[model samples]
Target: MVDKAVALLANLSTIAEGRLAIAREGGIPLLVEIVESGSRRGKENAASILLQLCLHNSKYCTLVLQEGAVPPLVALSQSGTPRAKEKV
Candidate 1:
């Protein structure tokens, strides 16, 4: 169920409005948490959403950094599943 929700958010994040909405709704911290400890697929989806949120957007990137996403993201990139690493 959590994985499904993260996947849905990942899909939603593909759009600019959805990225704004998710960021505005305080989704960054949750995504960072998921990257830290979610299931494999959930980590992948969460990382993908975070990437989408940060893409070419310094504000969102700052928010993600402020939420301390980098450490978990780096950990995921190094040790998460293949798809999760790709997302990271």
Candidate 2:
């Protein structure tokens, strides 16, 4: 269920409005938490969503970084699937 949600949000987050809406809804922390401890697909989805949130937006990028996303993002890039690595 959570994985599905993450994936849906990931897809939606591709757009600027969706990114702002998700971030406004406090989705960043949830995405980070999933990156930290979710299943492989969930991590991928969450990371993808986060990437969208930060894409071309310095404020969101800083927000994601401040939320402690760097470590897990680095870890995912090193050990996650190719899709996940691409998202990172």
Worst 10 residues of 2 by lDDT: 49-58
lDDT of 2 by residue, 1-88 (tens): 9988888898889888888899889988889999999999999999888887777588988999999999999999999999999999
What TM-score does each of the candidates earn? 0.95, 0.94
Candidate 2 C-alpha error for residue 14, in Å: 1.2
lDDT of 1 at 23: 88
- The most accurate candidate by TM-score is 1
Please report, in order, the local distance difference test score of every candidate based on alpha carbons: 0.90, 0.90
Per residue, candidate 1 scores C-alpha lDDT tens digits across 1-88 of 9999899999899988889889889899999999999998999999999889888588999999999998999999999988888878
